[model samples]
Target: MNQHIQPPTSTASSRIYDILRKDLVGGRFAAGEKLAINALKEQYQVGLSPLREALNKLAAYGLLIQENQRGFRVPRLSRAELDDIAQMRLALEGMAFEQAIVHGDAAWEAELLAAEHRLKCADMTLDKDDEWERLHTQFHRTLVAPCGSVWLLRFIEQLHDQFDRYRRLGPKMPVIRQELDQQHHELVELAMQRDAQAARTLLDDHIRKSYDVALQCFLEHSG
Candidate 1:
């Protein structure tokens, strides 16, 4: 006899939280925009309790800020914070690249090649899809998959997520895609050849360029 499997029930609070989080990170709820609970409840068709819970959860993630006596709003992206994050990302991701280069074997190389192919295919569209973003993220993750340190990879993943909020703004910037595609191709070449130093340098430059452009655009628009 075959056993029946059950799908897990989706919780309203988590669903509401995810929707708001996506909108916030996708730059839909622009920085410092007020997030009224009543409005969200009406918009999501949920009650006040779930809405409050969702907002509180997002506050913990630094995406939303709660003001005493006021309410929640999208946190403003500050240049200082962006720079600090970029510095941390450089250190972590650079180390990961080094480890992957030194330790990755044939299987890892094959996986990297497959991921690169998927990324190239998904990136063909000018209108970026969430699916393409997912595949792109997987490609980067696979590039560093040979690194043995779980803690370091976890930290790097968190930083990547934080940087993603700013990355959503990338499409609006002219020439960003062409520059990114070139950098990615170079990175893949260096990695495949086991040139750790060149890969690390390219990775660092790639991370910083996007951060610099995004920070400048954000500042100009906000100012």
Candidate 2:
């Protein structure tokens, strides 16, 4: 018995786009795996048109790659591509953090402090803690919230999204939690002290460490 499926509206496409974006960024899809539209339609309970629209939007965001006649696949990860993204993050985030140090006021410091506190309080016992991810992202964003440039913030966010996909591709390690927490503590202290030079240096090292971890995991998995 054939079932009648209603045509998808614009809202359906937008909803599907958001869901698909989250899955891609969350590493739900394997790297370089082709997305079979029929399979997705069944899995997501979405029609063909909305699924295609969502996939096309993801392709435009560099989250998916479109082949000539092969439909879309998750973008493959590579050391070169990872390095490029890290370098860009270091450069741009460095600029924004410096400006934040120079211009951030008491309120900004307070917000950053609160965010860091919440991040520290996040439970790490669970393997996939949504609270931790949210608080961690909040702390980083709050650290540079006073950069005073909308475009800079937007670009930084886009770069972070790309980097996060790589990071999530790797298995989460519990051994690094203490070190990461310490780094975040120091970053907060440096920002509070308005030590731009030290803060920037620490931030660069922090970012590089994440890249190294992602690269290591990538090599191990690929090998």
Clashes of each: 0, 0
Task: Report the C-alpha lDDT of model 1 over 1-223, residue by residue, as the tens digit.
Answer: 4346431222677888888877777777777788877777788898777778778887877788888645987777777777777899999999999999999999998898898888888777757777877787898899899898999898887777677777776545547766876787788899989999999999999988778666765577557
Off by over 4 Å in 2: 1-8, 123-128
Q: Point to the candidate with the largest TM-score.
A: 2
lDDT of 2 by residue, 11-72 (tens): 78998898888788777888888999999999898888777888888788788999965499
- Worst ten-residue run, lDDT, model 1? 1-10
Q: Local error of candidate 1 at 167, Å?
A: 3.3
Model 1 clash count equals 0
Which prediction has the highest lDDT against the true structure? 2
lDDT (Cα, 0-100) at 57 in candidate 2: 80
Q: How many Å off is the CA of 167 in candidate 2?
A: 1.7
The local distance difference test score of model 1 is 0.80
Backbone clashes in model 1, listed as residue pairs: none
